[model samples]
Target: MGDVFKALADPTRRAILDELQERNGQTLFEVCTRLISRHGLTSSRQAVSQHLDVLEAAGLVRTRREGRYKFHDLDTSPLRAITDRWQLPTD
Candidate 1:
């Protein structure tokens, strides 16, 4: 729950999740490209990488190495923690 709240505190991370949800298991480059287009500029790859690291640490995202690149996927289990802990209404 701590991790989920921490991860959701950042808009960038949330946006990253949205993208991954929409298109699961995207490569690092693909995630970066979506973020760049949505935010109107390419932030440094290092910056995006850092954001991914945080999300991964929070257990909200998972990564798999695909050849030379890492692919990201959403892990919604932490989100369920949030919903459960908060007792939020879910439809």
Candidate 2:
């Protein structure tokens, strides 16, 4: 859970998650492009790639390789865990 908090602490990381939620299975290039065009982020490809690495380490993002191309997908299980941990009694 520490990793999740750490990853979520960054605005850039949060934006990356939003992008993945809006459109799953995006390559590094696509992620960077959308961040620029949609969010007005000026981060470079390497910066975005580092952000993705942190997200993946936190279990909020998953990756797949197809031939030479790599794709990124969002995983919401960590978030579900957070909600489940704090859910109130339903009675």
Candidate 3:
């Protein structure tokens, strides 16, 4: 999907996805902490939240609210569609 590609085009978003893959079900604060510690990204909490929003719109990220906390998870099914469309033979 166009949205998926667009969302993944950003290095920051890709890093966010990587963070999710490494550790799913992370809250916004957790995500920001890991991004800065692991990737040296000094982005603000609001900026990271906006990146999460884009990823969610593209279906790359899914979020669920548990009381006051919101946890983010990665969904790679959109990428599967792309691979399925042009799958190479194993032979």
* Residue pairs in clash, model 1: none
TM-score for candidate 2: 0.90
**What lDDT tens digits, residue by residue, belong to model 2 across residues 1-91?**
3489889999989999999999999999999999999899999899999999999988999999999999999998988776788997798
lDDT for position 90 in model 1? 72
List clash counts for every candidate, in order.
0, 0, 0
- Per-model TM-score on C-alpha atoms: 0.85, 0.90, 0.90
Ranking by TM-score: 3, 2, 1
Candidate 1 segments whose C-alpha is farther than 4 A from its true place: none
RMSD (CA, Å), each prediction: 2.2, 2.0, 1.5
Clash count (model 2, backbone only) = 0
* Model 2 worst lDDT run, 10 consecutive residues: 80-89
Clashing pairs for predicted structure model 2, backbone only: none
